[model samples]
Target: MNNKKIFAFVIFISLVVASILLLGKDMFSPYVSFEYAQAHPDKYVQVIGRLGNNVPANTEGKGYTFTMTGESDEQMAAWTAEAKPANFEHAEELVVIGKFSREKNIFVADKVLTKCPSKYKKENN
Candidate 1:
């Protein structure tokens, strides 16, 4: 093969590999279940589930505890998570970034995203 052709091929491969590596970060990012999260303490994770059923009230004045339903039938179990300031009860979806406790069956979420559904404008008023 010509030297120029070889050089082009190498450059193309390098670009492809680099782009893939960048996109691969999101593809391989660990989005773990409540159980899996609980097992791996000290690691941040994005947990998706319904906001209800297990979080205990913050008696110590720290956070709110709530249960999240897993996405699968086999893993469809209630997982606990802590939402700080005692106002997480109002969240639409609990996307928690935190770790879990296998023994306690709970997650210590550092951040919470409360999805509040907005009301649409009434037309023809």
Candidate 2:
């Protein structure tokens, strides 16, 4: 191939790689601490915490409202449009994926995953 053809090929490959990197960045959103999520309200983040003792209440067809407490004792209210998971009352931990709403001072979750404590315990002989 001529020098121009080779140069063109290299440029095309570089462009393709750059595009993939840029697009892939948005495909994975890392889990962040509650403090970080609160600081960056506009970005999507995943928060892992335990549900607070307060009972979760239904929100007029919008979703459910509950409180979540992080490792550091930082608590935040979270609302999820998704249906409540089975055995939610017995969940030992929760992983919530969504963004914070500064206006409402709550974490508006797109998805909610629950981890039940009893399900993972080994049977005693």
Candidate 3:
């Protein structure tokens, strides 16, 4: 191939690789256990689990904090700056996405999603 053609091909390949690497695990499956998240405090990860018995309470700042029980039965502290999610108290399953903060010893949540049970949905008799 000519120099121009070869250069274009290389650029195309480089762009493709960069996109894949830069996107992070979010493009694939980002869900992980609490243990893995704690191990990689600098990386953002998603953890899906049930709410522990403790209720979420306001932080000294503006966010709310609580404990979540991972599917593996591992527990971790989670804090979210957003207002306590609707139905948070009754959520059967919840997913928290954020990076663990070793300084604060908590998972600083960027997003919180709650999955309510079928009771919240309308039933057809």
Candidate 4:
């Protein structure tokens, strides 16, 4: 290939690599601590915690309210405008994704993901 063709090919490949790196930077966000989420109320974040002691309560409409206990024992009030998941009570862990409302003192979740115990169930020998 000519010099110009080779140079253009290299530039194209470089641009593709850079674009992928930039786009994927925010694609896989790691779970944030409850404290961090609380502090950054404006930022959309994800928190993984075990289910709280209180039973998940149904809200006035179709929504539901629940609680989550963080790793350091941080108690967060969570509310979702969606029906409670069927496997919620059997979850070993919960991943709540949303922004915190500092004023309301609640983490309004956009989506709730339940980590079922079956994935980690012990098998008897």
Which regions of candidate 2 deviate over 4 angstroms?
1-27, 118-120, 123-125
The clash number for model 3 is: 0
Off by over 4 Å in 4: 1-27
Give the CA lDDT, 0 to 100, for residue 122 in model 3.
Answer: 75
Q: Write the per-residue lDDT of candidate 1 for residues 13-69, one digit (tens) a residue.
A: 999999998876544546677666666666667777656545443433454555566
lDDT assessment of candidate 3: 0.85
Candidate 3 lDDT over 65-87, as tens digits, reads: 99999877778988989888778
Q: Which pairs of residues clash in candidate 4, taking residues 3 or more apart in a chain or in different chains?
A: none
Report, for all candidates in order, the number of backbone clashes.
Answer: 3, 0, 0, 0
C-alpha lDDT score of every prediction, in listed order: 0.60, 0.86, 0.85, 0.86
TM-score against truth, every candidate: 0.50, 0.74, 0.73, 0.74
TM-score of 1: 0.50
Question: For candidate 4, lDDT tens digit of each residue in 2-51?
Answer: 99999999999999999988876544667999899999999778899988
Worst 10 residues of 1 by lDDT: 73-82
Q: Model 3 compared with the native: what TM-score? A: 0.73
What digit string (tens of lDDT, one per residue) describes model 2 on residues 25-101? 64478878999999999888888999887656556586898889888887888999988887777888999998999
Q: Return the clash pairs for model 2, or none.
A: none
Show pairs that collide, candidate 1. 38-100, 55-65, 55-66
Quick one: ranking by lDDT, best first? 2, 4, 3, 1
